[model samples]
Target: MQDEDRRRYHDLRPDWAESYIRLERAASLIRTYEVQFVPGLLQTPDYARAVLSVVHDDPGEVERRVGLRIRRQALLDAPGGPRLWAVVDEAALRRMIGGRELGRAQLDHLVALAERPNVKVQVAPFHFDGHAAAGGPFTILRFPDRDAPDVVVLEQLSGALYLDKPSDVEQYRRVMDRLCTQVEPLDRTAAILRAIRAEL
Candidate 1:
């Protein structure tokens, strides 16, 4: 990958820098949760543009970030790429972070990506009561190399936390497992996405 294809954050936080390396190098699986917006990997170009526009006022920076995001997504399609599973709260789908048209496009994009053999997308609906992941969004990355322990990434306003401690990884794994059970089944996600798109 080219140097510019790497993940780029405005703040250049050290945690994000390290996290990016792990993300690109991990060889087994990538699982993520989103409570407020579409997962970065799954966001459409237009939706990404909209989302980036909010945090960055500079057009050049916004465009650069969008390109980086899109490049990261290519990892999913690469040969022997990690299996990607994402669980998103239904509220994340409903929030109009990028306005109605772009939001709808984003949902449509999600529906399309869910069809890929290596990707799984599930939605935690509003009616689903008592969730295990009340602490907001996080990601679990498992590497093919046995020496590399599984890592749980917790993103905060200041930066990100990469937790590799066995206990911490196990706890987040349980939370993710519960979230999978609480969400709509994979078979039905496309239908729900289409319905949401129509409403938007």
Candidate 2:
């Protein structure tokens, strides 16, 4: 295979994609949980473009990044997407990044995603004391395959870190569980989204 082909294959490899893929796979097997922004797998393209546009200078590069995000979402529709459980901060829902229409669309998208059989959506209200996300947004992916390693993907301002170490992954898992417990349930989350849309 040519160098580019090799790279593409590597990117497409089933065992794992990157650190994120490993984490995502693990998330798929068991229950995966997210806190902060909507999980990448549930993000809408317009919301993604608006988020990416802030950091990327080149329009082409921005589009590529957006495309990558959309592709990442495919895992949600795959034969067995993980049992996706996401706790989104109220601030994230209120932030008007892509204008009212796009923001409304994103919220609508979230409502739809929450309806999926294997998916759960929760909302962490800003008024709650324990609602702050530690180290920003992070996901703890647990795999049904006991042999597969649990993974955590932490997003940062400069880049992202993928953690597979038992200790670190365990810590993130606890954090995710705590956040989920504190948030409103799926139906309430959808209601919150509706209220946000009404205001927009």
Report the C-alpha lDDT of model 2 over 1-200, residue by residue, as the tens digit: 23564354453343333555545644654444444355667889888888888777888777766767776677777786677777777888888887999989999998888888887888887778775354567666677778878867665665576788999877777777777777776668778888888999
TM-score: model 1 vs. ground truth: 0.92
How high is the CA lDDT of each candidate model? 0.84, 0.71
* Residue 133 error, candidate 1, Å: 0.7
**Per-residue lDDT of model 1, residues 26-91, tens digit only:** 657989999988888899999889888888899987887787778778888889988889999899
Q: Any runs in candidate 1 off by more than 4 Å, and if so which?
A: 4-15
**TM-score of each candidate?**
0.92, 0.82
Q: Specify the highest-TM-score model's number.
A: 1
Alpha carbon lDDT of residue 177, candidate 1?
95
Q: Candidate 2, after superposition: displacement of residue 88 in Å?
A: 0.7
